[model samples]
Target: MASPAAPQPGATDPTLIRNFCIIAHIDHGKSTLADRMLQHTGVVDDRAMRAQYLDRMDIERERGITIKSQAVRVPFTKQNGDDAGTTYILNLIDTPGHVDFTYEVSRSLAACEGAILLVDAAQGIEAQTLANLYLALEADLHVIPVLNKIDLPSAQPDKFAEELAHLVGCEPEDVLRVSAKTGEGVEAVLDAVVEQVDPPVGVADTSARAMIFDSVYDTYRGVVTYVRVVDGHLSHRDKIKMMSTGAVHEMLEVGVISPEPKKADRIGVGEVGYLITGVKEVRQSRVGDTVTSANKPATDPLGGYRHPNPMVFAGLYPMDGDDYPTLREALDKLQLNDAALQYEPETSGALGFGFRCGFLGLLHMEIVRERLEREFNLDLISTTPNVVYRVDMEDGSEHVVTNPSEYPTGKIAAVHEPVVRATVLTPTDYIGPVMDLCQTRRGTLLGMDYLSSDRVEIRYTLPLAEIVFDFFDALKSRTKGYASLDYEATGEQSADLVKVDILLQGDPVDAFSAIVHRDNAYSYGVALAQKLKELIPRQQFEVPIQAAIGARVIARETIRAIRKDVLAKCYGGDISRKRKLLEKQKEGKKRMKMVGRVEVPQEAFVAALSTGDSGGEKAKK
Candidate 1:
């Protein structure tokens, strides 16, 4: 990368202000680079600087991933020029790279005029790098390709630069190389931002047209919406209206984030900042809504504004009935910060009252679950996560099924499940294991290409169900942590799928039911029965643990009745004494004849999802 001289900061004009985001795959040093930039700008002191400075949550730091999009404003001084002392307000929005948060990335990119396309020097480009690079290009933003982690022992900056140039249509030699860990060549990054990337640009309208990219709730001030002003200016004294929701409120504060919420009297066009709208519900102050003055509103909302929809489905049930309201409160609060989550009231005979929740993907669901338990102090259990499937009955009517319990009671129909297109980048040695894992999930190979002598990229079309359960962990294990994958929706497909139900003591256990292909139903049923046998404890009388599809039993297991110890009449080992002891034992067995309902443990549900092999390998959350 060229260490160009920093351009002179022009007048206090919005055109000189650069608003951009650092986009990359997971663990590619996006947050670390953000911290370094903050440190260089002096917004954060050397002693205050820590790993993932912009990551605000404990879960994010613990998991080493960014869950939410965060933005910060920095002051940068120019090198040698007529306007050297003038400081430019640099707005940087840090986005998550996980496939689950792709929608978040798109919204973040839509708010920026340029992006630093960061890649790990050693790992090269993974699946998400290609996914997000296309998104950035689709937005028609300036992409400055850069490589990080250049100080590692196995650093291969030249090779990754060549691959990135070939794949993303950039010059290999021009790709910047720097070690974010050591702060080497860090100033060049700032120089490139000032010289190469363009300032934020927008509409010609005089009316205020701010695009609301993200929003969250504040306990004292209500909802604070993060936005990038496209035209005109926004002020705390003005009455603002959301074009999408038509909710108007008085703006209480307008400010930029210097890693914290700092107030300003007003924010101008081509600048990124936040506004506090005294709206109670966070949904009303939505992401992608247009924020404008009520008296002088914009004619239209900005392009690419959309509501987040549910992609993955699960059931969240509270352990105690008293916690039902608490659970709803937790979800409502969580929804204030996360627009991607969707939930509705649902009831279960086995587990009592709960909610049916929807998320963007598996990781999104896991994060929500963790937050509920850790943040809210609630005891909850989530059922097996499933994808939305379209069930076409023999009558030609179709409906979507989110839960196994919601499947049709009687049907002669076809089921179409959600399918995903996955891009897997792995080393050459683990090709067989990766292929076998995908094949077992009923995936169809799309294409393959060797990026270098040691690395290859393979694409496949697989069912979303297969990918949701332990596929990522399996891929990492098989490849010794060398494989990284990302997936996108490719519509749905018809499959010979059926619902498998588990019965305890001749009664159906609704939560333990699952949807599987007809060909694998018997095998899956056997696995479920065996797993239940081990998980469910013995009762006074015999308990029949059965796996059935409707009324037909495919597999069964019997927990033998507890035998009584009788030895009072076995004295002297005589035949009459032995007969007396047997008679007493028979009497004791008659007393335990009334069979009680068997109690199934929570582990049974988890163990039932371990259907791939008979060895009972549990699925990951």
Candidate 2:
């Protein structure tokens, strides 16, 4: 077993520092490659090593995906080349590959000088691979294309290498091929990183200025902010000010993660490390905020990241009313780490206290809810997810509705819903099925192109609401899991959308309300009404579940009443006696039906809101 090397003298020298991130499609061997790099650099010993070494969260480990962008300072000593025997500080950020975590990828790109565009040798280039490459190009980072999984029997490294080279505008021989599984040619990756990636440039003598790329809340240490020192240096015990919030805190600890936290006296220019300020409040340490010395602040804070626009919105209510405050606190902590999460206090008539939270997508919403339950230990019920909509009033005012209950009541001129331009890469045989799926979801064909002889790229403009749920699942099923999709918001368009409200026993259940397109309203109502009937328990009297739009009822289902055995006493008596007992029972049942309220249980809401039904019928009002 071996220990990681300590920071050598001149380790923070701008010329010796290389900041780069691995960007690729999901499961394209980014994390595995990162592990090999760590092993090759001797940052982790055999005893401390595990798969997906950069992913720390239990949920991430269980799902085998990179949800967060993890940074590690690997000290790679060049073995062969003109720079042989030279140790370079490599700040490697492992970014998420899912479309939902695009913001994480963007943030990581901003801090890096170059990116390793990884592609699966067997799977070739997928939709997310192109998406990430464009993002890196937009960030103006130097890109080194690499192909992983070359050892697999199905891998066509030569074919994919040509594809990668063509995509990157490089020669076919320029693409690096490696098997991350067997750790072959991984050293080549490190050597190429040092030779190709541009060194970070910054002035070390100026006032301290660092960009907070990420942050997390720890119960013991409070907020731990991860920053990339852009200019000057940050020293331990220095009072640092958050340039955005104008709040100041003393840096209790400054350290670098050499796959493990190692204390550092100062993080100089071109270095990446974490800073603990012991500030309990999460809002004070925002991602993208600039950290500067309080006494001699930099004249200008670096350009910060754009706020992520939440594409999906949902309501999260604690199952127990008493857990509301705990849920709020938990969300605050999560928001500090996931800058894309947005939430506000909201109250539902049926579900009681909760927050109206916005997420980047359906997966993002699911992950946030899981974190609330697993990490915070709170029982939560999340309403069906929906996209934000804008309602134009006849009075010339407009309102934005994230929740169904917030839909305008007055005369509405029109409702504009968010739209996304989706790109799908699939085999030529699956193009017809893919097109059919998109068309059924109210998609308009944008264009199509032949990426290769057998690979085709299809583009469509679709309503965000249509693809938020089940779309990906349906696509995978239709394509036999051979298609990859990526989408981005493409503004909004006025549409014939109506709010569908679900009423139980003539009272509206705010938790089950959703806004749907006019053409699909009847079907959505019918399906939701049917789903509620199966979920809601039978009451003393018959309960009628109705789905309505405004004052018009579109669909209804009835839950039969629990019969009382009033006739049991007269079982052996005369016919008149039995008739009288039945009549009395009917009268009593009618009276109870008139006065009784349907006490829908919390479990009913949770079950109905869950994605158990067709995505089209999700309660997304």
Candidate 3:
């Protein structure tokens, strides 16, 4: 017996079409599943399809994570003869699995009507899985759970399915067990997707209404807004007005997100398309906004169009001063694609020229920092991440401070700091260690429960300021890197924390500083002063390092003076190299922010001061 005929193209039947996003915890086979889907759809021939076909960036491929959400249209043929083998457009959006980019995942889900929740058979559901599942449900998308990586030796599909049913409130039969690696049960998932997910609701209308889901900057073409036509049909050369800005521009190109960019003269309702207007920047083409005809307007704009705000901040500086312009250009290019990233030119007396960059979270900061170094081939010196704090002055004034240097002192006032609702999933055996680690980081346990026989989920209300720098690393270390953590910003609360400034020489290093707990101030200051002593090169005079608690010295160190004079002796023969070296040293000295006559290294501005020693001293006191 021969296999059934594949579904044909242009199947208008709703049962044939499927629009879904594949969401998973990091390394749980999302991209691999996407590859299989593309291959099964025959979009790319077997020879052409690569591992992570959707991840175009080297960093994404190397890191084994999808940093950005990508959309691809695949045409699949149903095996059933109900519609005599019809072709359907399977619009698949692959979203980032990391918690830091959960906001991006949420936005991408708004464009889709269904989600394929992928879980590793061995690991079952993780903290991020629960988080993304909740987001999908909140968006009202039909969730189809899939057990991925069943080919692994430790696969436990049945247990995972049971957990999925219990955790997500889904039926056990509804969870499709599949190995994306071996192509087993993948067709069942596709079939379930077509059966469960609804198609575009209404017919295409010529009326002006389009929802911009995402936008990207094209060097030659300009800003290309990726939009889904909800209530109208848009065509090339059509003049459209941005509902948010009221700016009108003629469409230069209309295309779908596919290989070679399939050009469409027009896109109908429920179809996703990319519109290239002459607009040079993507900031104006805000995500979640509406695009309408200049003359004909829609009744109302789409909901959920709030702008993303950055919660964490750090200073980004070039290792070499000459690379400052290159770093700035790279940042501009990066911001063209990411609307949430914010930055401003900041000069640190010790670090020279740098930018104070804002990110959604710590993961977002790491991705950006990695991308800068890998994509732009530039070495960067990054400061510790800090949370923005809200301060209420006694004069009835409110101020937002990102760096510790800007924090108010000697003022009678109230201060508010950000906090997060954090969730951690780890092995049951590691709970004790994890709890101990959380307490040290100022995390308050709100709740805990057994997620499974061996795994437990712990909930904590943590100060965002505490976890902004190294909480994730600490948690991973404590749990032996088996814990999966997710967090969302809850709100601001009153706190007695103050910015403890680390002064190198006599001037303050803005980037190496942070807003710290007043109780732990002296220790943090001392550690930082010690770190600077190790990082900065010795000069002619001994440089004094001090951590001051509001002008009172609490922790102090000193860099011993240099005694070598080899350059001074080589006055004639090695004069050129010596002069060049001296000039380079002078340039380096210029880069260091001078406190009085002492020069401090840029690294001193961002290194965390060790508080352990200071804490011990305090205990003795």
Candidate 4:
């Protein structure tokens, strides 16, 4: 999205430019640290600022977390330091700290030359800190250790910094201490960034080339892509073509964020900015794709671009059947901003038409669903979140299953479920309970180590399905909120799985079909039958809800028939007459519905699969 022309007061010089991103564990104050740096550089007015100012979405602020990476250009004028008399163009990328958005960190790091590794002094080194530090190293970015929250009552910067230094292979004195809340020592972070973080260097070329790190869609202005110019320059006159998709468009505007999009004459080499292509289709300007001048195209696309792989799948159906077109439009617009989100139209016999969407993780799935309902104002019903399963059939072929209906029938070979390597950081006191919980979920202990005197790091290999539901919540509850987890899919392994079907009355309902482990099938089926019984209202006839595997029924429950007011019309005529009429009505009920279809409420279907707070609801019965 572009507005009237306005550029920040500064000279875009490559030699004085620093492109870097801030990385931290959740709740460790990365965004607050970013706000302090912005104030120090005079990019954001302190009086007009809000807390966690970098988070743009309402959900982000409400949750007190950064869900997306925000970019801004800061002009740091060093007056009394080693770099005095120099005004550097610092491009700061505020990255999300949660494990679900690790790919976001990777994308931001691809466009940066260095990173600020922020850690909490009170909490010390946690799970995400180690995970993110390794990601930065993998990207070969320079890392400057910054210890934050030194002002907290429990702050112990010396100890945490020492531990951090040991992990990064540096001296303890190299770590910088800062208090983001009080804006203390934040300037030191800026100075250290300029002095320690090297300036960005671009390929020597006159042909225009830029990398699209992220993008967002605007209804009025079309797709606005965020890009970092790697070589040459991008201006209003250039004809741009995406290297990956090959869709060409004329550049309408080029500008810098300065937090908000501001127009500029041009974005030159080694400069971070935005590109307004007026390209409505988001697929044309995908993240990690190279945007090059169509007339003078670059011989090769930019390196280090990997296609995003979504880890979770769920079916999102509109509450009303006629809203299918509206849902499609909303998804099209939503996917423009989120390149990692994948969606395709799917049909379910019970739920009708909907889309089977893929997400990076559970949080990603939640955010997408919330946005669809709140932002797009569409009522949606989501199925149970499932990991992609691999089915090895007896025909000597392998197939992937995204929906329960896709599960192969009469399989003779084997079924393989996804598995993940989970890392848990918790206090030493809670180690026993944590390990016990993991083992019960069919987890295999990989290793464990003490990070500090009272904190321990535990690693385990768990079935991806086990953790996809409420594993994080259970871990936190067991550790009394002292635990943080980070996980990555390792691969797939042999699993004994069966498709449990839910039959209403006598007919099977496809919406309640789930592929569960064989050992848990009976209990799971019983739970499903009980839950469905509660959700389905009593009709004229007793509705039999049964959970079955193959041809045999495993568990069954029934909703008792509602006693109609047949005696109301009797008017006290005769005791024998009333008895005969009641008997006739009871016999009529048996033949009236003849195992007809049963209707279930949306809430019942959701509560049956929802995790976290309502996990105990299904097992209650």
Name the candidate that leads on TM-score: 2
Give the Å shift of residue 349 in candidate 2.
Answer: 0.8
Whichever of 1 and 4 has more lDDT, that candidate is 4
Candidate 2 least-lDDT 10 residues: 612-621
User: Any residue pairs clashing in model 4, and if so which?
Assistant: none
Off by over 4 Å in 4: 1-11, 80-84, 571-575, 606-621
Better of 1 and 3 by lDDT: 1
Q: Model 2 over residues 2-57: C-alpha lDDT tens digits?
A: 22354552345788889999999988999999998888788887789999999999
Ranking by lDDT: 2, 4, 1, 3
Candidate 1 lDDT over 1-621, as tens digits, reads 212223322223776788889999987888899988888888888888788999998988878888898999887775667654545678898999888888889888888888999999988988789899999999898888999999999999989999888877878988999888888877788888888778876553489998888777777888778888888888777999889888888887788787677777778768778888777785787676788889988887777456666778889988778999999988987886787889999887777899999998878888888889999999887887888888987887887788898888667578899898999999999999999999998999999999888989999999988887678888888998788888888888999888898888788988888898887899988877887788777766678888898899999988877765566535566687777777877776556554466776766555554333211121111
Higher-TM-score candidate among 1 and 3? 1
Q: Which candidate do you rate higher for TM-score, 3 or 4? A: 4
Once fitted onto the true fold, the runs of candidate 2 whose alpha carbons sit more than 4 angstroms away are 1-6, 9-11, 80-84, 612-621
In angstroms, give how far residue 397 of model 4 lies from its true place.
3.5
Report lDDT (CA) for all predictions: 0.81, 0.90, 0.77, 0.84
Per-prediction TM-score, please?
0.91, 0.97, 0.88, 0.95
- What's the true lDDT of residue 323 in model 1? 99
| lDDT (C-alpha) at residue 301 in model 4 | 83
The TM-score obtained by model 1 is 0.91
Task: Rank all candidate structures by their TM-score, best first, as comma-separated numbers.
Answer: 2, 4, 1, 3
